[model samples]
Target: MTKQLASSAPDLPHLDLPHMGQVDDPWGGVGEGRLFTGAWVQARGGVIEVKEPATGRVLTLVGRAEAADVRAAAQAARVAQVDWAARAPTARAEVVEEAARVMGGMADTVVRWLMREAGSAGPKAQVEHQHALGFLRHAAAMGQEPQGHILASVPPRRSVAERVPLGVVGVIAPFNFPLVLALRAVAPALAAGNAVVLKPDPRTPVSGGFLIAQAFAAAGLPPGLLHVLPGGADVGQALCADPDIAMITFTGSTGAGRAVGELAGRHLKKVQLELGGKNALVILDDADIDLAARNAAWGAWLHQGQICMSTGRILVHHSLHDDLVTRLAAKARALPVGDPLDGVAIGPLIDPGQVARVDAIVQASVAAGARLVAGGTHDGRCYAPTVLAGVTPGMPAFDEEIFGPVAVVTAFADDDQAVDLANRGQYGLAAGVIGANVDRAVRLGARLRTGHLHINDQTVVAEPQAPFGGMGASGNGSRISGPANWDEFTTWRWTTVQPTAPAYPY
Candidate 1:
């Protein structure tokens, strides 16, 4: 049996709740009890509600829309976008900038809701909230500038390319990254002058939709320009299939992403799918076992391993496999698990379903002759950080994206075998190789099929300038936060202003 550390939940730092400011709690004046009541949605005709995953607490109610309602919301956004698109680029940028400012100031407020709703721990939740705000700020500061070009001197023919928005975008955000990922989609779409109807995860509507709506409203965006549709798969599928929705930017499972793609394809609409990842972490025999173990634990357990870029698979050299697993299990056990806001090192799975999923995967893996090396039990929504060894190629744990507090360890006899084991998974999102030989690791990294690879590092670190997304089943198209992302969200239209007489039609 894995030793359970005496549940010493860390002392979370004090945070003043309802940081939405006096008399301006976007929920309603801060003193108003109505905001906490389950009436906010009814008030907005069923838009959304804030549900805490740990205790099933309801923080705020919001619009719980249906298919027709989502369609109407999209139509409303389309109509509102007509004027929004006509606004000067500077004017549009101002709204997003103001949103960024508001979001920055309200980081505590958003983090509180994120902790409550998503069961994200203190520091990571705070970081993700800040990331969301930063992305919005950076997005606001970016825009398309004319880099006009002269065409070849073929008669009077001339052409120049200029970027333009894609009208209206339908944003379907994921549960694990309720706030940050939503902003990842919404900010760029808005910055590019597209109207967006945001469909936040129903499980975390408060943090994703309600809080964001408050920021947008404070930032002075048109009321209907950033419509919030808070509902379940039905609502999301409806939004995906809606013809008026010009583009779909979604972050979720591979299965769900595929469904979104098929639907969008049927409509001939562009879809950006940031889907599932079964990332690999290769531990070379020459690497520092302690360092690799710590990094691997962090990569696998952060967000309970729910993040798309998490290293779900670890291929260790047979020479160091036993030592690494022991170190990893100890490190994982040291992580505190409790109330997300209480500054524990880790928190619960996003919801009960996620917990169940994790439990099921762990059980299935163990039954298939895999060793349950550490931390596999569940307490309500909370799942202790887990590690599995002896996981083989034929097992479901190796084949599936185990979005939970579980890391499957397998040993490789040599570098070639390690690389082959890492590449065995169907999904190729992110991978890591920890080795002393940087040159050899780099060469081996090239051979890995993942979109992004980290040599002697964790796979999930996000830099604003880094191009972030995956290949194959992980993502379609792409979404990166830098200038690359700007390029993705824009369409270059070719135009020519006659500097001289036009050519006659032949």
Candidate 2:
């Protein structure tokens, strides 16, 4: 059992909650207070009330979905997908493009919901909203592009390969990046002409799931093309098992990803997973210690370090280890930790449970010989930005993905040792190398076994057109962003035609 630590720091003063009328009803006045399945319909299950992490204030009440609701949503998607696919790709692109425009218009409301529901700080919320818009527009553009190839076959036959939409895509998104994660998959899947059954984390129904449906609907997408069902594990299991759902794209913990992959495998359905990571930041001796410290602080403590690509481990060169640790610790201590709406540098964890989990990890790491360098205290939902040194390979702080505002540092003797130390963990999600020599840093980054790497930058970075996903335990074979996403949401069919009779071997 995880034990909670008594907070040694004082709580930050609370900010006044926004007016209720300002928050848009995600249901859009369809069902009285029910889940959105084409139109608002009452779920067979009960309701879930989301609470703000900073103050524990009631954010909103949303309907909780069950297996019956999942089936209904899946059926609706199955029916709508055929017509959606029949439409011109350009027409579909127009709808998605309109949705992006709508999202841009509603940026303020969306950012507020993200901060309240997902504990995102002001800047983080804004970035997530912007990224969501960019992703939507990118998807719209891809939808209009040519999607098939023609090739010469034997003799008089012509062979062609065309990309076709998978019937229904079941999207299960995480709470950390509620808006962006959902849109990252949803936009691409919709652009490919597949209907979507989105099951967002129950914790972020309005920000993560329903807001997406509202955007598309406002953009003039036909009813039933996207159904947002917010619920728990039961809902997710049902979505995975539904016969009508042809594919599953999930973003969450590695354990949950494994379970989802196994379930999808049993059904022989296509699945794309973007899971967790214990990312690392390597500081070479040639790096500027102050610059490295600032970048490391940003990557390790941003959004309370809830990001999947957060730098959980810092491997510094032996020569620079002491100086880097001192500078990084100072940076961590100075970060403002408070309410998300208050424009604080760091914010609360998603809930008390998350607070306890993070504290427990920190306590255990300290017990295992890791030295606490600075800020290992919590106040209410907020955990102070923390830095730990003397972390070793086998310690939990070094080996595990501590998803909090805490980072552990260890020293490496040389370049080869740094690479080995970075790759020793099971995760291969993201990494960073900080050095004055860009070429040397790039060479070292190439040797690291991570899916994405940065030189003289932080691990937590993403672009609209970058191929984003992980290898090994961090994710399965499928990737999410850039041109790579097209293959995951679509299937290729080879067609051959012979105008005239050709000699047949048979």
Candidate 3:
């Protein structure tokens, strides 16, 4: 069992909440209560109160937007994209790079917001900041890449193929890892000369939306180029259905992703969906016990395991299952869980409802005859790091994605059984294989049907410079990192020139 998270972080170094000056001018004199919908207009939707998950303290307020607001935001982006796209690609790149520089100065403010609003520990907040900046710079680099090719053609004719912006792009980012998720698409789309209408989850509007807007605006990005609307499902649907918005890029749950994809398909617009995962971590017989245990603990408990790529299942060879389980459970118990501001390795869930849902899954799995190897309880939203042994396919812990700090362990007979166990689920987001034999581990990873496979690594790894995405329920076969951006945010245009008349038209 875990103790209730306290309001103060007495054990950690000195901490200060955001005072009036720290957050006073984040919106350039606009009150913290309202969202900046491109034109500095107020939101038509009702007020949403931002609360600290551990203490239930109201941190700030933001608007919950309605569908009309989304349409207006999209229209504004449509109008601005013309001028924005008309600029030189290098100039666009400079603006994005400059935004990263300006945002670097606000690291303290960003960390505080992440800690209070998103329940991120210090290390995770730092990682988020660095990754957000990496995405921005990577987008800038992409803008400098050659977008067109001179094609070989028949005599007396020249052919060229170029990729151009898809005009206005709509982005919906989830509350978890909002900064990285929102920027990964938004930066690339903007760098490609497409204006973006971004819908941040209402649960984390400030850290997810306003911070990015402020940085870009401060960097001299043209007004109306981007609109940040913090809203719920209706607003997301409206953004997808807007006629001017050419594409919709969304990051969230699989159910929500399906809805977004369906709506965009109905409208004949492109959509990129990054959704849920029940990632697996496989421990082979030849692997180091301590290292495998460490990887499992990190993959399962980081950010309270709310991440989509969090390891949900651990498949170990029967020879090492018992010993590996014991070590991993001990490591899970040693980690502290509390308020994010307290500088603990693990932190609280977003709210009480999430706590109930996670606990209920753990309980159901136990009732289904799975052994509770470590933790099976919570105090408020601070659920203890949990481990379950003897999990099988029919149990809730095995089938459902328990997006909490819970690890489920299952034993396999051999390499073939390990492959079958890893590939048993619908989610194909990420998986990891740990073994002393590097060649054998890589060969095994190649057999698993996941988008991101790590050899001798954990499931929680991500790189801004690599192509990151998934298949099956995890995504729609679309990717959103590095060069993948060029495909997701732009379309092809073919141009041809003929000095002499041909057989056609004459």
Candidate 4:
């Protein structure tokens, strides 16, 4: 909706995004052909148009939401939560199972839609759907397992603690993982018998909301149990500040997370946040250059480095600095780029604005005397995967979270220096360590500040068994792992019974 200056192409890497199809031209952020909020209603003066990064193809335009509408939606969700929670656990589980089956039927169409709407590559978009399905199935299974309790013996009495659902839960999700993150909140909330008020990013609502609504309907959830409130900050603020909402779970910037936390604190409601990360990828002296290069590339470019756990900063041993940069640069340059639908390695950014922001960050880093080693050109919203070397600790590329394809590489003379440098950031989300010596890798991995550390590998996604959350700025004390997820959604009420009356203590 706001007009900024158009920039000339910057000199960096030669990244090419494949031409997938005839994407619409953008106006404000509403794509010309797509049927969105603007299409359904009269054109409001201010609209932010989302464009494909690679070809300047207009993807969608998001109109600003009215605050009044958001309040009404939140109020509606609060009214519906009680009845939804009263449903039997098995009944809830059956709905979750049915959601999975419904999602499975529409998998292909959903993947393609995500590719167009979110600019996600085929493989990655497919994985989002898979994650959605997994969350649904896992939640259903969890529901079947009855709430557990511990027994205590005193005099001749019995005691037990049972889990019960929290009331209306507000879920504010991010754009990077539109569908997957939505399911993450929905599955657990529903399984624990809580109703959810979902505020998805307007950027990719159709792709995310359509699938979720379909799944909920197929699962036989109550009509008003889950409400989709798609809009921007106004909507989010309303939901967070509302006293009726029992809890708020958010995934986004630290600033936004703080705001949500403040609002929840004021209401004395629970808040779970997964915030920013300037995650580090530490390459030890013993790491295999070839494998490390491959892993580092994946860490930097997957989802265009939009992931919360993305490896934005690279800490390498000084001894192998040149070798590491050369390998990483070569691998990055070699990756095929173009259309997301064609299954290219890198797709366009969610919108042109993101591409511009990422490009500016890379340029500013270079202007500050950091060397651009490889990949940094922009065609519309499409930016080539870039590598930066000769970076020092104070540089923005090293100090900040660059949620883009660019990775900053800083050389460390020894293991101690590498550890020190990696721990310099405010974030403690996730990190990756590369080494040939198993013992050294294991030992050094323990020293990293991140909550999730991977040894000689890059795949560190959420697993049903493993806990996922950060230590410091990355999150509050919350994790979506095993039974912990179930615990977060429910509260424990201790109940005591007496077979025979106990004597009073004198």
Candidate 5:
């Protein structure tokens, strides 16, 4: 396999991973260790060849997880969760806090691997690292937060409500923003005393799976409380259907989320879903076009526009559409797109399939009358930043989440028309409205249906302690992180007691 990590990255939170009797010195990733099933155990489903998206080069071979592995993990987590739940809240918090400390020290190593595995740009990878640290620290604080509430009861009677762990939580993560998204669920669940079975997207097992395992293990998290299984659809289905798993937290496309929601529903499991978005960035008539164009470029091209909150379409005032289009087109063509290791601003997508999908959207939008203002080309998997003008509702560029470096621009006459256009699709994930008049922008944003909105900034933003989720097709409104963790990772237990015994009404 490729050269191992040179003495860096932790193993996991209390994982018993071993190669023979010891793990490889510089842990490259979980791929270097096969699979993590309380240990570095090989999966029964055989091996998968991990490849670099930019070069399509075989990076390493990792054992592919299957349905059986998911069951075994659930069974183990169910048993281990009792002890994890029994630990002092401080004890649980310490583990997560320590993981964050360790993660901070190994920033360079993690970013390097993230670049190789997910084809992420340097700044984008660094953002993931910092955001993950925030998630861990935020989750750590949840342990010491108020656990329950004192209730007002009639004299001689006492009643109270407290949060309790859900026993076992399943996390199904996506390739884009894998580390932060997986940790957004995994860290909080652990802090709240729920054992987790994390299924990283097969394409990003290391950053989303193994890297987490390593960090927690080094921090002295108890064994069997967390298991990282890198696998395909069967494993995800098993996780949702397993009896031992009490809940599922998922982040992916709307189509995949529907499937997950359907399966979890059949089994009567609590589910938290964060799905896709075709968000809008509204440039108001009174706004500064130059500043708006800069934000649009960053939102539309950062990490190749793979982020779910990336600007899917831009709505500009008809008066300034031409000027904004000219500025955006120039910015799009200037962005360097290629290997992330070469220190470029944009990189190749996760794979060739993503490239094909991006190309199809561009071609279809142009065919439907959207003008290709700039860039409509690709070299290998690297799609040049593209700008489309005159895009409208029926065009793919306007309606679809083009998870690539492409900016689709549409124009509107007033705030009502802008809000109507933003709410045209099923996506209600995120949106942005920028203008010189902050009050007007806020008023318009308030009218929009998105779960999150920016009055003067871009759509792509995430605060670790915010109520991070969406509504409609974007999610089932099962918000995560911040105060939402208590809702997702724990169930309420209302207890009542009398001095002796309750009087029977018989």
Candidate 6:
């Protein structure tokens, strides 16, 4: 912990964090910490003040990095990657496993920071921490798995193929699920024998990037192998343009993902992108209205609907459309909305800009003939959980990705219409179907063109061992998590040997 300071600006409120025993001043030392080249150094680009969205309070200052800083970090990673890749797989796995243990021990501290910095509720923070830990452990175990394959060759010859790391991987993580998203790429990259340069969202530098660096350092990972640079798009651009960065793994908006993909393509660097989604949740006439409402509420309102796979569109059978909307509106109104530290279901948006964006979308939808069932209001940075009915296919409310606590409902005539609506979107990230007939729901799910489909479940679901990604504009062809990640972070090389010299045809 470092010395705490008060906000000098009168408009900025005082910091108020949850009380966790013996974990005083979670924001302390944040401004002074920049993990580079195996050491915590001060940022030369100055500092940025992080504010808690729940109260508009200045939480702490974080060191900001610029292009020079990014270049330095990349150079350091390049230098360290050789030794990191040279180590035995078992030895690397042990270090990652130890890091997971250390992170689990600091769960309380990490959760508090997540709530304060990222505006994540207590439950959401817990989920992020648990997922991060699980992924870290899984990655450690994967380190010892087979990395190559043996293939039959011509007579008296042998052939083999092995997966190799892509030197230095640059990971740009989003603010929504900062901790888990960053670690999802970092853990696998490390396990596959690649060094990493992480650029966490500037808005959540402390909880998103700094904490992971601390845990890995404490777990005795060789210094310089991992670097956390907390900065904005300029830093990210620098990272992508760096000649030494062999690959880029990014999680953010589709627009931003396209820019990254383009830059990486121009540079001939491997890139993996997990972008936005306008996911849908369908309710059949035979479904239990209460269960459907509950699932819809949880899927649409969790983390204020910031998740990429949040159910943004709800398609219901015309027979049950009105009933489902009524029940869902009630569920939305009943949810607690307030400060994240207090364990509320709906917390503040990441910033005023987001609140304005969501509010504007809701207002526009209403003007465009969508009926507001409940919510559709904002107080400070907090937007109420909103439900809108009569949403049509062409409206922005139905067509766009509203990254907020907003759910749009549209009625469909039959299963064909429902599946058609689900598959109509350009984004094919995820979708959910709820029905009494499980077989029917599964059949419909098969027809929908989505990367992931849930029968009687919400779209917002992920496990560390599941192959998670999207199709079309939602993401690139690459997938992350589980064994699929190994393919993305590594390259394949084929080797061959002969027992005796053979004459060349030439």
Most accurate candidate by TM-score:
5
> lDDT of all the models against the reference?
0.77, 0.85, 0.85, 0.73, 0.87, 0.85
lDDT of 4 by residue, 1-506 (tens): 00110111111111111111123421122232221221123223245454444555555443444555555555766677777777788888888888889888877666766666677776787788887788788888877787868677675677888888888788888888788877787788888888787777777665655457656765677766776656678778887787768888888888888888997888888888888888888888888888877787888889888888888788888888899889888877887666664557788777767777888888888889899989889666778889999998777888888888887889998888888988896789888889999889878879989888888886345665456778788888677645777767888888888887768897
TM-score of each: 0.89, 0.93, 0.93, 0.86, 0.94, 0.93
Stretches off by above 4 angstroms in model 2 are 1-32, 500-506
**Which structure is stronger by TM-score: 1 or 6?**
6
What is the TM-score of candidate 4? Answer: 0.86
Best by lDDT: 5
The CA lDDT at 246 in model 3 is 98
RMSD, every candidate, angstroms: 5.0, 5.6, 3.9, 7.4, 4.1, 5.0
lDDT of 5: 0.87
The superposed Cα distance between candidate 5 and the true structure at residue 442, in angstroms, equals 0.7
Can you write out model 1's per-residue Cα lDDT over 1-506, one digit (the tens) per residue? 11121122222222233421223233343232112111122323343445567666555544466777777777877888888878877788899989988888886567666777788876777788888877887777675444235566564556666677777889899889888888877887887788888888877766777677778877888867787777788877887788788888888999999999998888898878888998998888889888889888888889889899888898888899899889888877888787675567778787777788889988998999999889989788888888899999988889899899787899999888878888886688899999999998888888898878899997777755566778889988576677765666667778866667757798
Prediction 2 global C-alpha lDDT: 0.85
Range of the 10 consecutive residues with the lowest summed lDDT in candidate 3: 12-21
lDDT of 3: 0.85
Where model 6 places Cα greater than 4 Å from the true spot, the runs are: 1-35, 500-506
Which is the better candidate, 1 or 4, if ranked by TM-score? 1
Candidate 3: tens digits of C-alpha lDDT, residues 1-506: 21223233322121121211122223233233455655455566766777778777665667677888878778888899999999999999999999999878777777667877888877887789988999999998987798989999986789999989999999999988979999998899999999998888888887888889888988889988888888778888898899999999999899989989999999999999999999999999999988999999889988899999999899999999999889988887888888776667787899898999999999999999999989888988899999999999989999988889999999999999999999987899999999999999999999999999999998998878888889899999999988888889999999999987678875
Cα displacement (Å) at residue 188, model 2: 0.7
